[model samples]
Target chain A: MNLTQGTADPRPANPVRVVIVDDHAIFRSGLKADLGPSIHVVGEAATVEQAVAVIAEQRPDVVLLDVHLPGGLGGGGREVIAGSAALLGSTRFLALSVSDAAEDVVAVIRAGARGYVTKTISGAEITDAVFRVAGGDAVFSPRLAGFVLDAFGTAPADIADDELDKLSARELEVMRLIARGYSYKEVAKELFISIKTVETHVSAVLRKLQLSSRHELTKWAAERRLL
Target chain B: MATIPVRPPLARSSDRVIAGVCSGLAVHLGWPVKNVRVGMALATLAGGAGLVFYAWLWIMVPTADEAARRNARRPASPIAPAVSQPSGPGAFAPGIASPAVQAQGAAAADMTAAPLPGPPSAAGASPLRGASGSSTADAGQPEATPWFRFRSMKYGKEILLGCGLLLVAGIMIAQMLGVDVPLGTLIPAAAVLGGASIAWMQLDETRRAGLVDKTKADQAGGWARLAAGLALVVAGVLVMVSGSGSWEQTWLALLSSVAVLGGVVLVLLPWALKFWRDLESERAGRIREMERAEIAAHLHDSVLQTLALIQRRAGNEHDVVRLARAQERELRGWLFQDPGREAGQLSDRIKAAAAEVEDLLGNAVEVVSVGDAAMTEAHEAMVQASREAMFNASRHGGGTVSVYLEASEAQAEIFIKDRGPGFELSDVPEDRLGVRESIIGRMKRHGGTAAILNTGTGTEVRLRLQSAGTDAAEGKP
Candidate 1:
């Protein structure tokens, strides 16, 4: 629990606090070292049980989560989030894994993780993702965002079946790109719209589907085999 | 009176009828021959027991000529030396040197000396002699039998034709004498002659046994023989039935003919069926052998080649481990699972392969596929070759290797770009077969093209495979 250094980012009065949950000690320490002082590492846990306990006690602004872990009813990162359901309002979850499998991405996202990025990405990209998730924005790698968009995008028949006809075609398009594992910037670029407009369509799509988050939308689309 | 010398029993050859057992006994026991004959005839008239008894004694007693023949044929017994020594008065009796006397004494001595390994007594000797004699007779009988001899004779066919002519001549002579020949007799005689001819021409036991050794090529011939035999037997029965004077007699003739034919068929059917079954099994065995050869060739082409490649790179521990892991995944999938014929698109497979390679080598591979190409026949080969090229790039290149897949209806092309300091193609040693064989050769065999280029920035391997309706083009810069 080291949180002394926070000098690099002076924009926020309090720096984004992150609890690193990973099964590997070297990876946790490496990620912590790479995050620098701008993102304070308040606590670290190597398993789901420890992750839940630490996240509950620390109530960090964002939890940098690994999708697979040992212990805590075998749910891995999902178990930690489910176990700490109460603190989810205050604390966000950002998934970091070496797997780029679409199933892994959709599974963690469905469990209420704000973003999913592979371990191959640079440390700076991960730091940016954590801050963005801390600020209440969904972050995803370009390909991972495609996975989310594909998983959540409604098929033509499903729109009528799930009563998703309330969403406009533009909003559905935005949702498709976003839920298929594309980042907001990529979705905006793909649709030839601004990032703000992409955000507006995502919120509308979520609202029309009566979903609270993009993660749930992705789970809904995946259940319908849209991806 | 010249004293009749006492000797072993002998049948008198001159007074013999049916081997002269009564005369032999009469001589041996000092009875009158007429009394012996009258007594035998009375006993035979009483029951059949006397006839059997006569037959037994006939076989037991040797004739005077046969006794002389036995004396001539006898191997000089070891006991001859003892008799020659004349240790007893009996041995020194007069005429003892004569062969008949010596043979009689030896036979008596052999009967007494049970431990001696001399020839068995005449009564015991019959069965052993019968067994050996029958075996030789069986071996020689085929050659000596009239049918076989007739068939084998140089002029046998002409002699048979002459016999037919003689029969016809006899019928004509009967006609000239105003003696009517019945059609029924003539038809039956023709049937019997025809059956005999067919059996002689076709039903050779040696040839049939040879057919059993041959393949199914002789199946038609076997059926023809069966049909011919059945027809002949039926014709004979029909002719016999029609020729009979009364309905009861015709039925009796028909029943007897059917019973005889049925017995013949019952004996031969099993052999015919077994021969047919053997031929069928031989054909099935040949087909199975061909299938096995095909499977063996497929294993040699794929799995064995991978195993050989794994062995060749044994010195590179990392490469070996990585290749082993990849091969294990592939082989397990091949052996345990269906070959994913209904799998996802080509892009998905390419991504999956890249991910697998990345996992094995701890490297980063960024797969960016632009189009969705449903997997076709050539897609599998293209994916495999592209995976190999990607693996090569990842192993030798610097920075994250980027795979760009452009799949169109006409063709699908994949380019693997890496930022490493690329070496000239000539710099690769002859022993480095991974690129030449697994990548280039694999693509070539699939009617695809693979090009390795050293650009200013890094190395790029391009693979292109044509789909349906497109002519396969060679590598282009």
Candidate 2:
């Protein structure tokens, strides 16, 4: 369906510019073909070093990043994000992976990736994710949703002032539904709420996932150095 | 018997302690060096003939390096080429030559190696025979059993010998300063100390040899050293007691000691051989484990990656995709089997059910799980309900079905969605209990909940079960 039709860029003339970063050339070409005409493919890279340079030179609005790449001190996608830290504000990153590792998704998210989706997702779903990320919204697959739910335990009513890292009651409900494989529209209908309300709850949870607490930020920083 | 002396060439070992004579004779006869040393010492003290024999052996036998060079130049006798240069590049290169050639080389080596030592544990001992029975007995072993470790004793024996020499030097220096020690007592005392040190060195060798594959020769060698050592000490004490004893009386004492010690070794030989055989088998098992690990690494690098590439490239062909996925699953299970987490877990059971439905109906079912929980009655109920949902989606939907499972410390949840024609809960009659009895009723009976909803596009089955312990603590069912 046309899930992101209404949320298109304000200037219709300017499509969401994206750079594809994956190790497989065949997969990259296939994704370029599948991304359709709405999103423009500006540059492509096969390794971490090449990805960083291409991302900087293209200055694309969104970067479709693979969670595992070959180069740059073996840090993979996280290294690419760390290398282009200055461009995180104007350029959003959306990680796509076929890896069954939860730590990889969490590490990339903590490294300032806007969202994560599996490579198995439909072309339409990936296309919609790119636009949503470009518009400053967070996208999470069912697997990532489950990870977030597990990361932040079930929320209690009336959150205390010091529990800033905990998810809210409404956000918990939305995340649980997503973890149970619900689409945004399906979750909205299931909860008798608007799709925009569901998006707001999810984005809030995404923000918490990225900057959970000072302790978590410190842990991520240490882990990055080890990588 | 005075038969042909078809022995491994008489080459003096570079791994030697004194003049390389005893160790060289030991290797040639496939006897432990300690036994050879003790025999030579006894014979020397008896008539002074052993010292002359040792001196002749040292001059006659060539060093291992010279033997290896001579063997390299020879055209016949492939056995020497294998044993003469044990650490050479050609030693362990398997599959390099034709099978016929290898068998011929091995047979030639085995004929000369027939009486080498160590029971033939595997097939007839294949080339590479020498002091380390490990190499002689098994050809498949990639590592050469280190002979120098036993022969040289690293620096332990050297240090012991050094200390003994220093003590002798100090005694001599004191005598030169006009101390009242008699020369007769000093000479006997030196013999006692020297024999004791040699015995001590062999004891150390026995302890270290226990970890490796110790053979009959090694055990006999140790026993020989201990017997020789005690005999020497006894002879020294007898001479000290009979001050200014005649040479004939000293000879009788040494001969009796050797005879008595030989009996003790004869009694212990059988038991020591059996124990060392057990150790040999244990080492063989460890080598097998290492080979398995190597095979796993090779398969993971080549076969597993190729299967993954096949699945990715043939994504549209359902049959090809299914076959590749099944192969990948089987391979991964074999390569990364974790004994602690098996098919009995809730997630594994559900995935197995999905795979059954897929294989039976030819419909694709994707299962994803996160955060496993302890298996309980409530968890079983949820898995049963999820299995029913997957089968329903596969049979009726005629398209791909997706199953998602997430579990926390206190609760577990499953969601099954399909791209099927939507069905209304109100549309079914009371008599139709497929959804009610199997899916919804099964969950309620176990203190869980199951729901069937019609998303505007398709159908979604959601099942959730809170742990019974959590339910009681919260006072909710």
Best prediction by DockQ: 2
Question: Could you give candidate 2's per-residue lDDT for residues B169-192 as a string of tens digits?
Answer: 797679769896665666677677
DockQ result, candidate 1 = 0.01
Model 2: share of real contacts kept? 0.16
The CAPRI classification for model 2 reads as incorrect
lDDT tens digits by residue: candidate 1, B234-295: 77668656665674587577678679977896677668667865876677577657645765
Q: Which candidate is the best by TM-score?
A: 2
Give lDDT per model, in order.
Answer: 0.59, 0.66
Give residue B256's error in model 2 in angstroms.
36
Clashing pairs in 2: none
Model 2: DockQ vs. true structure:
0.07
Model 2 Cα shift for residue B399 (angstroms): 4.3
* Model 2 ranges off by over 4 Å: A1-13, A155-164, A214-221, A224-227, B1-316, B327-343, B362-364, B368-370, B398-400, B408-410, B429-433, B466-477
Error of 2 at B225 (Å): 18
